[model samples]
Target: MTAHETTLCTLFAEVLGLPRVHPGQSFTGLGGDSIQAIQVVSRARLAGLVVTTREVLRSESVSALAAAARTDDRTRDRSGPVTPPRRFGPLAATPIMEWLGELDGPVDTYNQSLVVRTPAGFDAPAAERLVQALLDTHDVLRLRLPEGLAAPVPAARIPEPGTVSAAALVACVDARFATDEELPALMRGHMRAARALLSPREGTMLRAVLLDRGADRQGRLALVVHHLAVDGVSWRILQDDLRTCWAALASGAAPAPDPVHTPFAHWADLLRAEATSGRRMAEAARWDDVLRPAPAPLAGVRAPGPLDPETARNTHVLTLPPEFTGPLLTAAPGLVNGTVNDVLLTGLALAVLNWRRDGDGDGPPGTDPAGGRVLVDVEGHGREDVVDGLDLSRTVGWFTTVYPVRLDLGPTDPADARAAGPALGAALRRVKEDLRAVPDKGIGFGLLRHLNSHTGPGLARRGIPEIGFNYLGRFPMGDDRAWSAAPGHAFALDDADEGLPMAHAVEVNAAAHEGPDGLTLNATWTWAGNAYPGTRVRALAEEWFAMLRALARYTAKPGAAALTPSDVSLADISQADLDSFESQLGELL
Candidate 1:
């Protein structure tokens, strides 16, 4: 390799934590993404090799980037010290917050937990210190529900990070002596912490437990935080930042993360302020038309009995190795001019339609034998490019956006399995096009429902999609620990589901990882069993896997047209029209 090529390769290896960057490997082929892409550009600038995000995106190899990279001095703004908060201080209810808050039961189901296998010989004090450091750094943990009397505090005052109690930073137990024997006790403590964070009565939104397993040579660190404080993207940034900060502190250095220019509080305030502006209102109006006479959101929920605490959302999982994941990543996104996310949702729509055909349940809640239409509430990470000046990529908090998507799968026949193909293909295409039509990836939904004074979350004003779906990118270990510096450094984050029924009929969250185990896709399906029988939900889960695999095959075929169903909407296409169309396209489809 030439000198410039070798230099770029070294930089890629260091930034991405890879052992080597072959001349043939692309940045993404080595597990790089947008954030990592930007990281390379930033580091490259500092390394005296100027590379733009565009160049990074297009480069086929290290040498390609090297050939185009050039050093150019440019001034950039750096985040300054913390500022005082003025407006946007309230625990302002966005659509997501309102949805969870209005669920008519204990909010403990919003609790999320993650378990980590600490570095060998990792001790309690060290773990506790790391917890404290995180508390001192991230302000999201300082928020609460303002339980009673508004605490008689001064106006416009936002709590700073690390103001909360250190002891409550985490709850720990030394299980080094009896790992197995202490399992039950450890669980109790974990659950206790989770319950504590679930309420503002504790004046905390996060809890941690450090399990000291010295003899066993594996120590476990568990973090339980309320959904109000973090999302999946926040988790990714938090874990990466925590690892870097923890290592620095261990070596006796002060912990510092990339400047959080916009504290979550400021972001929330700005969000509310912006919601009232013409932009948000106009966006909401456009969406209102798109979702009006809202496609009935389907959920296999029977009577959601008084929020039974013991009712846990069960999961039927499917794993896919690299053999499938690798190609799927390349083809799935291109098929619809969408990302892997589109593929997942498309597959989900197909599965839901199939479930309907199999007599799993009725459409939405009512409307007799409804024409084949499914409405689903979809979730996005909420870090869209909409915010021009602020970079929320590293900001921690609940930046989740929820919006309804109506899928028009013209005429699905359960009795005749042969007729399902055309329906599935057309449905997938419509879903892709519908999503493509959404403005700024659906951020307007929250702004209109909660921030907009005119609109309310009430059934008469704003409709609710009974089902929710999220694709949480990829898990760390899922990709063979490629992102980690060493093996056994992988960690897993999961919901410690309490078996409590969700207000919605069912919700699905999928995470991906690629390793020697291949590319494994773990899809967790949570449904209110009373509505859809457990057996039915399980069938849906299994069928989703089959449909997803089928999609991969369909997209991979030679000269397969990733064509749109039609400019004419499926709803416009009458039931009679669908029958006529399906019959004509039967064998060709």
Candidate 2:
């Protein structure tokens, strides 16, 4: 192999945890995902090779990527650690501003948590030191919310870590669990106590629960952090940092994890400017159309009520088998010139339309999902490269954006598996095009609706979708021995108050994981129980999975996948015109 190819293979093996990677081995085929791809690109840049996330996915193979990779100094610092600004101040680009305005809802539930195992001999003092280092390293972990949103200086800020106490930042508790079955209930109890322990206004946003088994057995550690300071990507960063800090502390060296690529506070300031930019203001009208109320009431929905944790919230889990998931994540995307999200959502749109059509007509008094349109609020990572010289690959915070999307896949055939092939293809094309039309991956929507002074009021007055969709990107399972996800302990979220209102009637959170079997996509459907029957929701979930299965089978055929007009940025052309152009070009060749 050439020099670049050698470097690419080494990076691939390290990131994917393989003994070695051959030139012809595909990236996705080897279980690499967009999340891992970012790490590869970052490492490659440090080695004087410029390879982007897109290139890693598109070029798949080590040799192919090496040939396409170029030498550049522009991105050398793209993944390096970033230091805090000299002066800590308020951040205006707060995406949670709208949520903060709801005074009655419980703020404690708005948090994410993870449970992992600590190395042998890991105890209280080491864990405490690790927490202090983490708070000092990531500025967002030290964020403070004002007592009231109406306060004069209500914007959140990251105070210098020197003045903060690690013990105060996160409440710590140590307990013992004798067996695996006892772990779940014990973790649940700790999570409930966290509701009282975690307070954004008090700058107490984390709760660390240490689970001890026998001294011979490895112990478990749970870190529950408020959503304001973390997101899905941020967890991976924390895991890496924790491992680094643990090793350093074990060796009697001060643990110094990677620096922040761009501080969350800095990004907040940039978003404040971007929200009121002339370009964003021009998008006000387009957003107005997207947020327009649905023509008909959603199927199986009763009069909506507040998002209650105890009575209203219900969950149904759905999965696509590993056999189908492997292709869906790798080959299926290449077929349609899209990403896994596009294909997965295409299945969802088809299932929703079909389920509504086949319903007992017992839907609330109007046409179910009128005119074959399904309105959904989609969640994004919100870390777009909108601002030059700003990289958020390592930054942590609740940098998430929620925007509405209308999946308009005109009428299709009823639910007949044999004849669903044509409908699947058409739906894929329509949904892919719809997502492509989202401006800046839907980042500006939150800004205009909540942050912009001129457009905020008008956008806020518009209706929100009844359904929400969030696809947490695919990730590899626990491979690191030093600090990996706890085995047989599933509890991860802090318990929310029962009286808080939900944002949507139903919210779908989907993620794919590589397991011993292969890759599997798991989706959890959470809905307000009072508004929708559990039986009906389960039926809908089954329909969604069936649609995904059909999509996977259809794409397995020869010549099933082809580029659509929206896949090209050259000019606006209908699918028919593009198909004709491809046919002619093929004939000439």
Whose TM-score is greatest here?
Answer: 2
- Residue-by-residue lDDT tens digits, candidate 1, 524-583: 777665555678778878877777766666665654434453334664654346445656
After TM-score superposition, the amount by which residue 57's alpha carbon in candidate 1 deviates from its true location, in angstroms, is: 8.2
True-structure Cα RMSD, model 2: 4.1
Q: What is the lDDT of candidate 2?
A: 0.72
In candidate 1, stretches whose alpha carbon ends up further than 4 angstroms from where it belongs are 1-91, 148-157, 178-198, 214-218, 290-310, 313-315, 318-326, 359-372, 409-428, 457-462, 478-501, 561-589
Candidate RMSDs in order: 6.8, 4.1
Q: Score each candidate by Cα lDDT.
A: 0.60, 0.72
Candidate achieving the largest lDDT: 2
Q: lDDT score, residue 73, model 1?
A: 41
